[model samples]
Target chain A: MKLLEDRIRQDGTIKPGNVLKVDQFLNHQCDVALFDQMGAEWATIFACKPIDKILTIEASGIGIACCVARHFGDVPVVFAKKSQSINLDGDQYVSKIYSYTKQREFPVIVSKRFLTAGEHVLLIDDFLANGKAMNGLIEICKEAGVVIEGIGIAIEKGFQEGGRELRAAGYDVQSLAIVKSMDPDQGTIEFA
Target chain B: MKLLEDRIRQDGTIKPGNVLKVDQFLNHQCDVALFDQMGAEWATIFACKPIDKILTIEASGIGIACCVARHFGDVPVVFAKKSQSINLDGDQYVSKIYSYTKQREFPVIVSKRFLTAGEHVLLIDDFLANGKAMNGLIEICKEAGVVIEGIGIAIEKGFQEGGRELRAAGYDVQSLAIVKSMDPDQGTIEFA
Candidate 1:
């Protein structure tokens, strides 16, 4: 995770309210090369676990999930859509999530056919803050009767309790870079 | 393309209202191996063009775009987000798009910083039907004054006017698999 930490320190922007923007290469504008490294790291970390599928939320998580899926021997990546679409009919495992970034609550849904019973699932995402999205995905996995193998994240806000809570709960959670602290006025970031 | 066509014929579900669900591999539950082939195909097709970046819409398009970017020598992949967030605060190029699948309209926004003038961009998407999403992406590129090399689509509804219109308008649009027609009752699909 040294590369990711360095990239964050170099390219990440600090703003008020604990915002660390790495849009240049992490989220909005993606760097596939960096993602490849992150994916390789995730694969190496979870090499022992049995991962049948990679689950993620829509928007930001898709790219990282796709990259990680390749590393996991091209496991199928199923992303939960933020809104229900006509195509996604039939039984679904839905969970409501509050987005601190957008400041809204939305239902994240996955077709029941995708995540079936007894499958080993690894949840992946771009950022982890309050862990609302991660919890929602975990809820969906539980409802589908899938075995939660682990969680992979590109960046984790160390100031937040999401990572700590998941670790305390005995989940195998791995984050590439963790921002321990940030100062908006000085534009400084400390890594954990 | 033959592989993709075969995948559709074998795994794709035909529903009423012209819905051909290939979510098992193409979108929701993505096949990174197939996407790698797609990325190679697009790279071969547009090898002559000077593409500085790969542009796409969020959610479904990000995975395909990331794969395509890898084939294009790991060019930056910039995705237009469907909603506004706290991180996206500066000058943005916004376009409204009507979603036939979701049956609603949403605004797609790209920060002006990621896409700049004089850069060559290629738009990639999972599906092209009414061309609203593609057009919205094109509008965002134009607003940023980026030169569009072309548009790459994994599946295009040939029965729909989107592909025809774009081709007629002299845009270099390439669709890997084009569904000429579909019958829900008979469970038949014809490719163009």
Candidate 2:
């Protein structure tokens, strides 16, 4: 976690609208080495839980989730698809998620065949903002009657209610780097 | 490569219209361990080239790209974004690609900062059908003035023209598993 925070401090840019531009290393242009480290950290924290599958949203979260799956003894990773595709057919557990970054609501879905009843699922993502995506994933898991083991995130905006709301709901949520505050004018970031 | 071919033969479903449903282990639900094997194989194959970075498209390619990056000494992996978002700003290299599976064309964009001139990039993807995505990625790299060392694909539809076109164009293309043919009724698959 310290390594992640340090890397964020060194390379992350603070922008208006409380956005942290970490595309240099975290999302667009990824640092797989850092992802492996974060994966190890998540595996250590969630070692006690029974994680049958790692769930995530498409695009950004897939990289970190894949690395985390490696640390979890090569557990299978299931990513929820944000857009409906021809390849995705059959019964699916669908939920609507509001993307604060994209500033819109879209449907995220996982095939029913991928998730089943009584399975212990660990949800992973790149960032936690308003907790809308997490809630959507949780909703799908609940619909499938699967047990929510925990949620692991690469970065979390501490000023946002997503992390706080999950913690208040008694979910074991862990974030590698939590941004406490950001000052765009000063180009400064405070981590929690 | 044998491991991947075997896994595909075992779990891969043969649907009509030449659709190989490998979502169980390749795309939707991913096997990181197998991906590491594929990565090791790719690294061994592309070891002769000077690869400074691993480039890929978002969603499915990110997982294998991350694993492949690890095998390449933790090289940075940059995934081109399929959709535009707030986080993506500044100069970008964009290309339009037609999806054979999704049955539509979309734009793939990469930040100019991540890819620069004189860098050797290796493109990685889960599947190579018509090669539209690969072509799109190659176009982006060309626009950035980056040298494409080669292209790596997990599964190449040999019946399709994509692989043939790339090889004809003098690009070093390596596919771990190339499906020569598939019979839906008999549930049979042939690999090239």
Error of 2 at A2 (Å): 1.1
lDDT of 2 by residue, B6-34 (tens): 99999999888999999999999999999
Per-model C-alpha lDDT, please? 0.93, 0.93
Classify candidate 1 by CAPRI docking class: high
Instruction: Tell me, by DockQ, which candidate is best.
Output: 1
Query: Per-residue CA lDDT of candidate 1, range A112-152, in tens?
Result: 98998999999999999889999999989889999999999
Q: Can you tell me the CAPRI class of model 2?
A: high
Show model 2 residue runs off by greater than 4 Å. Answer: none
Clashing residue pairs in candidate 1 (N, C-alpha, C atoms within 3 angstroms): none
Clashing pairs for model 2 are none
TM-score per candidate for chain A alone: 0.98, 0.98
* Residues A56-112 of candidate 2: C-alpha lDDT, one tens digit per residue: 998899999998898888889999999887788889999999887777888998999
